[model samples]
Target chain A: MSRQALAELFSRCRAENRAALLPYMTAGLPDPEGSVRLFVAMAEAGADGFEVGIPYADPLMDGPVIQAAGDRALAAGSGVEVALDILEQVVAETGRPSVVMTYVNPVLRMGPEVFAQRLSQAGASGAIIADLPVDEALPFASALDRHGMGLVLFVAPTTTEARLENVVQASPPFVYGVAELGVTGERDMASSHIGSLVARVRKHSEVPVVAGVGIATPDQARSAAAAADGVIVGSALVRRVMEADTVDAAEDALRVAVGELADAIRRD
Target chain B: MRLDRPDNQGRFAEYGGQFAPETLMPALEELETEFAKAWDDPGFHNELNKLLADFVGRPTPVYRAERLSDQLGIDLYLKREDLAHTGAHKINNTMGQALLTKRMGKNRVIAETGAGQHGVATATACALLGQECVVYMGEKDIERQALNVQRMRMLGTEVRPVTSGAGTLKDAVSAAMRDWVATVDTTHYIIGSVVGPHPFPWMVRELQKVIGEELQEQMDGSQRPHPDVIVACVGGGSNAMGIFYPYVGSDVRLVGVEAAGYGLETGEHGASLVAGSPGVIHGSMTYLLQDVQGQILEAHSISAGLDYPGVGPEHAYFKDRQLVEYTSITDEEAVEAVNLLASVEGIIPALETAHALAWIAKEADSLRGQTVALNLSGRGDKDVQQIIDLVDADE
Candidate 1:
């Protein structure tokens, strides 16, 4: 998928008075079929986009909830190929855009060219290489672009203005603004200076900016959406899925959370 | 006689192999080639020897422990590596690898440190070589060894505190390895000990052989050409191997001592050589203290130097060949030896080295008529304040 396609999806979410959105969940978490069902359910519940996490042995940026989910996925013998297969099933069921979120090791292990080809063939909308800095991303970025897949770049709160500009220049899709200095989690969002951060990133790029990392409640989602074009909620949604007594309970909790967030963003 | 028997596939007696990710295969292969060439290069040896003598303050003293020996009724000698620059034997290996990294054209040095000794050593070399240095340390270690953290910062090295996986040495190593894999082009990971994948154990052991080599020359000049027994503490076993390698075929009995923590039978210990079973961890098949399901268990020791779950593959080889006898010393014994040596010999020993001292004290009666050489691997200067504080706390 092209940058234009992602922008179009964001536009539709905004036109519908909803948050231009993405929800992240580790693939094969709990179980393969259940995780796939949740992904399809989230898309059906009006999630504009999805980030399918390829579980890793060391997910350095993840919080306890996501880490536990990833551990469950890995223990179940889930890998990048398994994650892609699940994504394929979700895409076939929901027909919504999905991106593969992973650290650079698995991609490097699979070979960049092969990874790009496999992602494109699996119908993934884009790829987010979390640990690949712009200085070291040329090879992977070029391969993704060659395979007609968008390479989403993460701009952290600690990133300098010069580095932010470099990231904007290197990014193929929307710039993902990490909401904090640390990993993903359900943190108190009262002190987040996301509005100023979004403004700074907006000055550097023409692309949409999506705020993520520690966004949990509908209030935080609305606050993030007020500043940026999109709000990405990961750890909170992952926690709900993991803590739910059953798959149906998980889907219900996710639908209610997404609905509340959608309404909060749509409010004038 | 060669102790390292690389199989046809280049394994070290079922212990060593290239277990790194495929992304590092080419680089590892390149390192293997460069190392083979450098091992044979007279110029490389000359440079390393010069650096060892000038930079590292090598030929570290072979001081006879008069007071301690007199008390135990035995002749005792100490290999004073504590006097080496940077306060330990760790710098010897770091300087060698940093020089090799420079020769390989790598512009940066990255390493994982346990007790911060290795971090300081690597940072010192990086500062001298004008290479960018980043040291990964566990968060827990940074808090415990705050002085070393400041030392690294003062040396202009970036010290990254890894907060993952219980925040200890093992996690620090995992993080460093991941960083090395990602930044292979511009980075060289200087492994702190004789652990990790192939080439590290071989490289570190070769660099550290100076301890044994110097001991040989020093003994030759003295009345006794060789001691009846050689004792050294084994963490990852570099220091022990350094003092033991040259005497492998000799009549000198080699003894490796490991930390017993509370006690070896309590399952709360770092005695990999004594209480551990054979297993694979961090790319080497060595004796590891692992759980029933094969997961590596966290090791416990009052001394950070001994807090490792597995030993180096070379030590494993020696143990299997029965060339060396491995044993354990309890925390109480180690502490007693520390105080005993300090009061009797005017030399404070590192807690890790105290394990060897403790073992020597126990076996002193049996070995009374014979001379024994002990590797005082590092001075207790870095550990002195902590030891005093602990003693006072107990009192």
Candidate 2:
């Protein structure tokens, strides 16, 4: 059911001849109440779907912006349960298919089956474990599948073609293709290597490929959108939310960034 | 005893596995393949043995601590890893890994340090081999281990200070792993302990098992060549694993001592084996100090080397199997043990090593007349300033 919902969203975007604009926000970040408000506002501002980040202590793959935001969410008493609660609300209230993004440790600690069951119960579409390798995706993938939710896998520019075939074989709702070599952060432009990575991913599976990391500006997002099926905007919007002094102002700034990114991916 | 470990997927009976990011998977796989080939290659062993003898001054002596043994009423033998180059058993693994780095055609190595012994050792090996060396240390550790920082710089290493998460070993590990993710092609992350993902725990243990092999050979003619008890300090559990691996199926008792900062009751300690729950940290599923919500809590210890929040996953497996018994020693007691060993045996032990000595001191009455081999893991020359401050406070 959840996989179908995500697939329909992707199909709808393809029919419209635009890449899906998936805006990411750390769940319960800054504060639980404010984060929910921001998620709702971004949804209204034309975000095609939501990628709600479940804050973890050691976010090795995150840059300063997302890490700081995650720290704030954790400090504000947002544990795994709270993050799931917020994820449920974002999907329910915004009426958009939402995916929970987190490191693998939390899921492992929570018991993968239980965690998957909770996500399914929470109305989440799927999950993207940033640190879980495709080879080690068995128990996790099987558990999520039992709940009719997808486990998204990653394909990096550094990924070898042989490994790319293995990753695509897992059959995720989409492949998360990293745009650059480093962690998640905004850059002035996307790496040209992403186009080749997406093309390589296409050779193995028919799954939609979404490129993320280092995409900040709308032009960068537009370029990333051209290479893949969709583009994920995270750090750029997260930084705007963090830099704003007031919660209201943070919400406004996030909505504006989402609007421009959504517009960038849209076909004229 | 024929010990079967780390099944096909690197799981040490559901404990150890490669629990890292997607990007690092290929590198880890490559490392595993290379390590397996190197282990089977006699030429690789010959080169590593030559380095161990010439560069690291291996075959480290086991001294009978007569005075301390008499005082404690036990036949105590000290495996003097302190005598090794870079002042610890850490050099053993570093030398082996550095050679592997060369074999892999990687010219740069990245490492993380807490007390800086591993950093110094890694820097030394990289210098000898002409490889670029970068060491990541937590900012707080940089303040405490300043002298080692200078030593590292003098030896042509770049010490990058990490200011994240409690500013300690766990954070340094996180930073090093992040660096590896970005530079996996040109750099090999020389993890400083028997921790992290699959091949690391297995590779480091195999590299360090030389300590046990030597001790067994040295005691070949002794009445009690097989000791009744083998004790060592556990920080990511490298030294303990090294010393304990050879005697696994024997009648020998393996004991690991963790640091209890104030007391176990006070909840400010690095005694993960004693008080921690099972969780994943720094790549492997292990015992770690984590809250109910799975956020890793900061572990505190006066000894910087033992102040990490997690223990190696293999140690966790042993603890669960009743193969090894783990306990804790407080800071005050460990400090006294340091002073006692220095005065009685004329040997200053690293604070991390002192914890093992401290445990023997407490258990002397019950362990009377039994042969106890304690791993004196490192020398305390680098711990002079920290010891001075403690002594000053005492006076």
lDDT of 1 by residue, B16-96 (tens): 655444334445656666877887899989998888889888889988887888889888999999889888899989988
- Report the Cα RMSD per candidate: 10.6, 1.5
Query: For model 1, what is the alpha-carbon lDDT of residue B178?
Result: 66
Q: Give the per-residue lDDT digits (tens) of candidate 1, residues A160-180.
A: 666677778886687777776
Using TM-score as the measure, the top candidate is 2
**Candidate 2 chain B, run of 10 with poorest lDDT:** B1-10
Please state the Cα-based DockQ of model 1 relative to the true two-chain complex.
0.04
> Which CAPRI level is candidate 1?
incorrect
lDDT of 1 at B161: 90
Give the Cα error of residue B64 in candidate 1, in Å: 0.8
- On residues B66-98, what C-alpha lDDT tens digit does candidate 2 reach at each position? 999999999999999999998999999999999
Residue A150 displacement in candidate 1 (angstroms): 30
Worst 10 residues of 1 chain B by lDDT: B18-27
